[model samples]
Target: MLTTSQILKKVKELEIKSKRLTRHLFTGEYHSAFKGRGMSFKEVREYTAGDDIRFIDWNVSARFNHPFSKLFEEERELTMMLLADISASSLFGTVLARKKDMVTEIGAVLGFSAISNNDKVGSVLFSEDIEKYIPPKKGRDHGLYIVRELLTREGKKKGTDISRALRYLNNTTRQKCIVFVLSDFLDPGFADALRVAGKKHDVIGIKVYDPMDMQLPDAGVLEIEDAESGQVARIDTSDYLVRKAHQDAFFRHSEWCKQVFTRAGCDLLHISTKEDYVKVLQKFFIGRT
Candidate 1:
């Protein structure tokens, strides 16, 4: 647990870092990647030389006895929701930071990027249940609040229930939104809910993981404990077959997750605690463009 002052300092650091990253790297990509609802009619005005003839309002022109052009504006404001998993599994990491910490940083960056693009930023923190939901709102203060919450939040339940989180998001929001689901994806049974949510909204899956989670290091005998469920097991990492099985299991799980998102017609990004997530995110943004 972090003290209030410590938390505040970390929050401030994240704010600065997020804002800087948003301004320098993400603003344009973020703005272009996700589109708003649609164009809306703003007003009617006399047709100009460069105005599109398609926009010429025939009825208005006939009424006013002139060439009137309908002016439309892109409904540029978007709602970006971050569904973050804060389960006990997120606390385990062998690299630079825990999965939870990386998720918080990434969430902060996304929030700041959304706010920079004049979009509403919100978050749903979940474990086995919804830990907290901050309704979508605009402004820097709101983004900061989200960063702080992401930093200090502790899960009430040890396990992950992504389906519950998705269902909550689907029922609560009436409008379509850009939803980023961040998790290590240790749990199962969320494919249906994810597909349903994807059909209605722009869904992106961010799998934050540790390198150790992918494969076991040759450390001879080791004791492993399940973070979500307090189950423990002893295994010989030095055994070739044991290591191969562990690696194969990890690969199967990762492949399964990819298939789930792919079938849902959603994009998924895999990031590890040892790698630069910013680069991964940048690649994703550019790829979308």
Candidate 2:
């Protein structure tokens, strides 16, 4: 646990770093990536050549006996929500940072970027249930609060249920939002809920993991604890079959994440704790642009 002063200091550090990255590295990329995401209907006008047929106003056209079209203006402001997993599994790290630490940094950066663009930013922190929901709001203070919460908050439960968070999100917010789901993705059976949420919002899944989650070191004998279940077991890492099984488990989880996100028509990014997540985020934003 972190002391009050300690948490305050860490929050300030992250806020500064995240603001710098948002200002210099992510400002333009983030803007261009989500530009024109929210569009609002403006007015109806006579159809012109090369107008999108999908936007045609059929009823108005029939009333006037001519083709008409609906015009839309891009919404200048967008809302961003971070669906962060604060599960116990996130505490396990064998490299630069724990999964939860990486998630906090990424979430802070994203919040700063959104606020920089004059957009509203919020978060939904979850363990097995909906822990908290910070409604979308603008300003530096709100962003700072989010960073503080992310840095200090720990899971109150054991496992992760992404569907619960998604359902909560759908029930609470009626507007279309840019949603970022950050997790180790250790749970399954969230496809249906994810698909439903994706249809109404722009959703992205971020998988934060550690090297140990993929493969165990070739130590002779080691005791490992399941963070979620609090179960401990001894295994011989030197055994080839044991290592293979570990790798295979990670592969299965990765594949399931990919399939679920793909089927829901959402984007998914994987970042290792040892890697530079800033570059990965920049590349994703640029690719979207």
Question: All candidates' lDDT scores?
Answer: 0.94, 0.94
TM-score per prediction, in order, is: 0.96, 0.88
Residue 217, model 1, lDDT: 92
**TM-score of candidate 1 on Cα atoms, chains taken together:** 0.96
lDDT of 1 by residue, 37-104 (tens): 88999999999899999999999999989999999988999999999999999899887999999999
Residue range 186-215, candidate 2, lDDT tens digits = 887799999999999999999999999999
Worst 10-residue lDDT window for candidate 2 reads: 31-40
Backbone clash count for every predicted candidate, in the order shown: 0, 0
lDDT of 1: 0.94
Instruction: Give candidate 2's root-mean-square deviation (CA, Å).
Output: 5.0
Query: Counting only residues 3 or more apart in sequence or on different chains, how many pairs clash (N, Cα, C under 3 Å) in candidate 2?
Result: 0
